[model samples]
Target: MGKWSNQINGRGNWSFTKYIYDNLYNFQWINRENNEIEDNLILTKSISLERVEQYIYFKDIFKGEYFSKLLEIPEALEELKIHMPEGYKTKEDIIDVINSRALNPNLKALDMSLPTHLNFVLISLNLPPHEGEVNDPMEYIVDALEKKYTKEENN
Candidate 1:
């Protein structure tokens, strides 16, 4: 069995998104035997706002149900970065700070799937302070994809 396959099979502890996030941290390269391998080292380099800008440009390509909410997070984070009082420096730190906002454990019983979580966040964000009514982010994403992919089919 190959090293990658071994790791792949051994990934029972990691969630699928977590696994992808972890692998993305590595600098992958071909080894002497033409095997694809990653340098088994974690980078200490912090993901800065500058890096986040570059990340946002390609973020749309990573569309899952959570894509729009994930995209909005970076924007929310960037704003928080500027407004943050002294101490926070890295994006991870800012994420922690954002997460610190007071909230109640008002979670209700329902399907706890990834797609469901994505829809929850989308609905919450689109909720209004006496203005626009909430729209389903998932539907927006589907419509956008249909327009992009189906346009060529019609042509």
Candidate 2:
């Protein structure tokens, strides 16, 4: 396991780290039966806290449609942005969670043909379901940022 896994060993009955470990594909791009990963899909093994943070905080610009819902959480709207899986979108044809902010990070990894479960990219940010905390992925982002800053200060 990598360094990030240390902080998130218990993730609501589903270890996201284990999921990545189990599902990591050797090839960068492969047509996995039901889906065709045209662009370089995220090499699951290469995933780290820094990379996941980068993808969430800076990589993909939020569309106005999605940002509209984000308006409900002004602070989160300012900080978090969704990670657009490579090849999932193109200038010509893009299919994003524009309909609703489901907060699922692994866009179609589970299977696009299947339904979306709104997993909300929690592991990367070092956030948690935290027993009784509001289970929304966006809700824990503040906690993740605070934790990162706290660690940085100590370091």
Candidate 3:
């Protein structure tokens, strides 16, 4: 129904795109739930990709407790490369994928583990925009997640 849906229609079976879309909604739900909880009662809070990486590094170094066994950074990156559209080499291609997925309503849902997925993709890939670069996939992802969450909240 939207630009993302059109793009998805143009290409059949965009599993990775669907994965990102679903995860973004899931992450948003988790954030909402975290916000609803009492501050002192919260045990673990949502974190950024950088923090995830740091935790992974520290866990590997100290062999301490494993926080989450979901998709790891390396695996997430490999999956991104595998699912990326053919001949997509530029950063815009990546941004398009993120935007398209964000706009895709069919795949939106509350999976709750989305931040893990997002962190995996973000830490594994280079999403920052360079000089003269017009699109930033990172920002698109955040906006998409927020928009989807807002829509869900209203409903």
Q: Which pairs clash in model 1?
A: none
Model 2 Cα shift for residue 37 (angstroms): 37
lDDT of 2 at 145: 65
lDDT of prediction 1: 0.39
Residue runs of model 1 more than 4 Å from their true location after superposition: 1-77, 80-86, 89-112, 127-155
Tens digits of per-residue lDDT, candidate 1, 36-116, equal 232333332363212111111112232233433553577655765686658874665545544442311212122123244
- lDDT values, one for every candidate: 0.39, 0.39, 0.35
Candidate 2 lDDT over 20-123, as tens digits, reads 45655322222344232323323355563222221222113245555556555756533433344454433222234443356444443433422222234444
Flag the better candidate by lDDT, 1 or 3: 1
Residue-level lDDT tens digits of model 3 in 1-155: 11121112332321111233333211111123223211111112242222111111211211112212222456644555576779753444544555454434433332233333554544444433233332433454555557666887999
Model 2 regions lying over 4 Å from their true place: 1-120, 135-137
Worst 10 residues of 1 by lDDT: 49-58
